[model samples]
Target: MSKSILFIELNPGMESTGAKALRICKNMGILTYVVTSDKSFYDSSLGNPLNDAEKVYEHRTDLYHIIDLVEYIKKLNTTHQFRAVTSLSELYVEQAAFISKALGIKNHNYEAIKLARSKYAWRDFLRNKGYAMPKFIFIKDINGLAYVPDEIGFPCVIKPVDGAASVAVSVCDNLNELNVAYEELINYPGFGRGITLNKLAIVEEYLEGDVYSAEYVVYKHESYCLGFTDRIISGYPYFAETGAGFPAKLLNEKKSKFYIESIINIMNFDNCILHIEFIEEKNGDIQIIDLNPRLCGALIAPMIYEATGIDPIKTLIEILIGDEPNLKRTKNRYCESRYVGAQCCGKLIEVKGFQQENLKVG
Candidate 1:
């Protein structure tokens, strides 16, 4: 019997996880249906990327844009059956949960996703559950900072309650910087004066440390450790991640252990995927930074596969489809990702060299 699966917002075919999913489904002969808002996502990027078995379903539904996706998924369910749904898009994780519940498919709960997406809510949840986290303030009003102590002060980071790719993230040195960051955050892309944006901005004491990310698979209420990666950042004041490399070569071994246990304890996972960020201080104390219930971008999945010979994405998908996945590590190798940085701010011309090297495409 052939299995059916739905993938949401599979874009820019060069995306590692997306490409892997497409390849896997195609190879397994799964009746794959790829969905995205833009029909061009199929034609322009995903076109002929996978084998003929995988089918593309284009709809004008921005899965992350809220209402449209929910309605569209409901509409799609009336006509087609989806056994599982997967995507690397962090923004659509909740919507996927909603759709899964609506269609009676295997997936995490909407409440779980809500807790996963919102930094302020997740922090409070962790603290309430007796888990350790950084000192944080959820800012509903920009003026609320005036009452807070300045020592919690400059060099702190402010970010939206629910955002991805470090978008609208800013590090404030003082009151003036914080104020400017606040204004810029409110006007950020993909956010508006609505329920989504009003959840609150998180102001946290900047935990100084080497940045790293953990990728894991949550199955049967237990989280399986995949591996860790070092985050590469670019820009200033609001340094967004350029890429990631695996395995994380942190100076301290205990710090990596702390990251894994702390993340598992906080996320309360049972059959899911988690991408967590952490900072390791000079004193070797590890602090959790941010958490997402999805895959990290910049080809970290493939990187992890190269490093540990463990594919977290496959395990995640297997769990999503109600299949027991093997979580054991097979082999280990060192892997790194080089960000394709532009020398000058100009239109992207073309890329080369992939055809010659054994480098994994996407």
Candidate 2:
């Protein structure tokens, strides 16, 4: 039987980490298969994720339905032996976990993934475990506004329970600002890609500190800290990320390593890559911001590779298939990614300092 790996969905973007994963698997002589709802996802122009895959199965509807997804995979398994199942998109993390469980493959705990994906649930878990985290409350509706404690008063952050990329994330400095933030996010379209927003939001005390993330991989219950990166965000109101640089200078290696291990022990995460964000106060106290059960999105993987010579996506694939990853550092250098958001949404007409040779537009 030929070895094969299944991807729940290939993320679409110019610098898609999912496409990188597919290429790595193909280079390793493993047959690649992708399950996506849109057949157009295979278009050659969009990084051609399908180019690396041997087969593409279209599950337009019920893609997240575990029973249906499992049935579809089983039917396909009769013809192709699927040795592992995984996903590169945050939207499909839970689905991948469930499918792996159904197939009896090694994977992160489904319950733990669920908790990690939900900000409220993750915060509650940390609080219960005596971890340092910002005070937060779950708001189910407008009526829940009364429950916001005075301590979590003005200058709090409001965001969806399950969200990414800083979409609809905002800060409220007063009651009126809080109301506006609530109204805007409550009606925000495309939350979870039309899956509905869960009608839940989290308002938490804004921790004042420098933001940084620790990227790591867990194999056989052991965690390896790949590296730490500094996160630069747009100041005030809108918390959109401006840039990120690998080998963060502000991170305390010993303290960060201890926190990452504590989180893994509490969540019992296994056989997955974790991107954990945290805040370091002026006094050096560390407080967790969020935990994701997947590779860091955008150009983070590439930046990390460029700086430390470790490919996180490739490491994840090897771990998924029960192989030890080569973690040797081949080089040491600085890598950073910066984005300049458009002031107005429109087509491009002219360009500036971003030369073709020095930078990638997307």
Candidate 3:
């Protein structure tokens, strides 16, 4: 039987885990079909791999938005019979889950993925389950922002319920600041990739502390840890993750792992790869600050492989195709990534790839 798979929102290159998985699939001889935005697929500045992959994958990708992808895939599957349908992009993961169900492919529950997509809904679910989370309230519209619940108080964070990459995330200490954040968040149109915005704002109590991620590769009935990544967070109230180091240099490793797993088991997420980010509070309480259903982004896959020798991207792909994944850690090393950002936001004219020969510690 021929192996085939559907990848949704596969960002062309950018060292993303999705891009890495696409390369792996092509190498494995899987007929790959992608549904992604034109902006990412054709951008050469990010080293567009699709230019070459289009020939190897046995299909030429046309510019298709997320809205038309589902129906189009359904029609195409009549002939292709895709074995797996998945995406690591926040904009399309939920849709991909639904497509998997629609195609009778084994994947996570669509509702679970949906819940994960909306920060407000996810937070509400956690609260109802008696999970320890910071105080929060959901604002349906600009009118709703005026009634900021007193229970949450000031010094809280406000962000789009369906946001990613800290697009409109902000911290507000008073009503004036709250209005500013709400305005900024609500004005942003959509979550990119042509997907509709959730249009809901979530105001959460500010979590003050050190940040780290509890990375896992759940195979079969057991969850495996690839080790935590110590996060270097900056951008003030924006909380942009500027850098990270694998095998987080911290004490009480066992306790933190146990605490994080307990929360994961409760969420009952069925994705093969689980990347949950948490904050070790100033007062010593560990709480899950963000839960991402995909691999840890920011080019974290290389770090995981360098430190643990476990290929998380391949592991996820295997699990999606109903195969057992390898979770063995073959190496004990340290790897870290530091991101460079422009001082002012502007349209990308181009991006220069790093030269390996000239690389040095800053």
The pairs that clash in candidate 3 are: none
lDDT of each: 0.70, 0.80, 0.74
Tens-place lDDT digits, model 2, residues 215-278: 9888777888888889989979897888999988753678768877888878989878999988
Model 2 pairs whose backbones collide: none
**Runs off by more than 4 Å, candidate 2:** 41-48, 60-64, 149-151, 191-194, 354-362
Ranking of all predicted structures according to lDDT, beginning with the best and ending with the worst: 2, 3, 1
TM agreement with the true structure for every prediction = 0.84, 0.93, 0.88
Residue-pair clashes, model 3: 0
- Residue 311 displacement in candidate 2 (angstroms): 0.9
Ranking by TM-score: 2, 3, 1
Best by lDDT: 2
lDDT of 2 at 150: 72
In candidate 3, where is summed lDDT lowest over 10 consecutive residues? 54-63
lDDT of 3 at 140: 90
Which numbered prediction scores highest in TM-score against the true structure?
2
